[model samples]
Target: MGFGSYDESEQDNQEYDTDFEDEDGLDAEENAHEGDIEYEFTASNDELLDRLEDIKDNQNT
Candidate 1:
């Protein structure tokens, strides 16, 4: 079979990459912290309590 009629005006008007800048047209800084932030590994009892609280709150909602 052959392709039917099409309308090109329905296509997206903006470019995907350059749409995120400020009014002056510049990319903003990504991270607030200087350099790259690193995560520390440690075991904590707070994890279990926080998880249980989250579950309870979600259930109540």
Candidate 2:
């Protein structure tokens, strides 16, 4: 006997629709933002290289 009385097929469909409707889809769209905000991050070449090295070392260890 099953643990609960609810049907499995109906539950699966409800969960599927909820997942699709809730997705933001920002990353998937070609031009999702359309220039709402401007963001920038700048650093010297040496500083960028140092950060890269730190990341590599962390991954190796």
Candidate 3:
């Protein structure tokens, strides 16, 4: 066979070590809550409507 040729005899001799531990503590299944996210929009309804109207006018032009 060539250099990269696949051999059926060599497949049976392969050994893999599946026993291993993660260095970080993330291996265990645990849920860690970070914090709650809060958002506040200061724009009024009239201001938002005006902005939408301006966008529509600019797109038409």
Candidate 4:
């Protein structure tokens, strides 16, 4: 019964609340977006590959 102590008998007498339903938050369609996205990247394939290699080399140290 001291501070930070554990009791096996107290564990058997405990009741846990299992209710976990909440309708006031987080709807499935709240962030739905319907649109066509278009973009153009000016970086060439070789430039992007060199940058990625540089990042990998930096992380190895």
Candidate number achieving the greatest lDDT relative to the actual structure? 4
lDDT of each: 0.70, 0.75, 0.86, 0.92
Backbone clashes per model, in order?
0, 0, 0, 0
Query: Per-residue error at 58 for model 1, in Å?
Result: 0.4
How accurate locally is residue 47 in candidate 3, as Cα lDDT from 0 to 100? 97
Q: Ten-residue segment with the worst summed lDDT in candidate 3?
A: 24-33
lDDT of 4 at 2: 96
Model 1 C-alpha lDDT versus the unseen true structure: 0.70
lDDT of 2 at 1: 44
Candidate number that wins on TM-score, 1 or 2 = 2
lDDT of 4 by residue, 1-61 (tens): 7999998899999999777688756887889999999989999999999999999999999
What global local distance difference test value does model 4 have? 0.92
Rank ordering of all candidates by lDDT, starting from the highest: 4, 3, 2, 1
Model 2 stretches astray by more than 4 angstroms: 1-31
Give the clashing residue pairs of candidate 1, or none. Answer: none
TM-score of 4: 0.74
Expressed as tens digits, the lDDT of each residue in 1-61 for candidate 3 is 8898898999999999877667634744467667898989899999999999999999999
Candidate 2 has what TM-score? Answer: 0.39
lDDT string, candidate 2, 11-55, tens digits: 657633455543555556665666577757698889989999999
Instruction: Report the lDDT tens digits of candidate 1 across residue range 1-61.
Output: 3598656764666456655546665545654466687888574779868888999999999
- Quickly count the clashes in candidate 4: 0
- Candidates 3 and 4: which is better by TM-score? 4
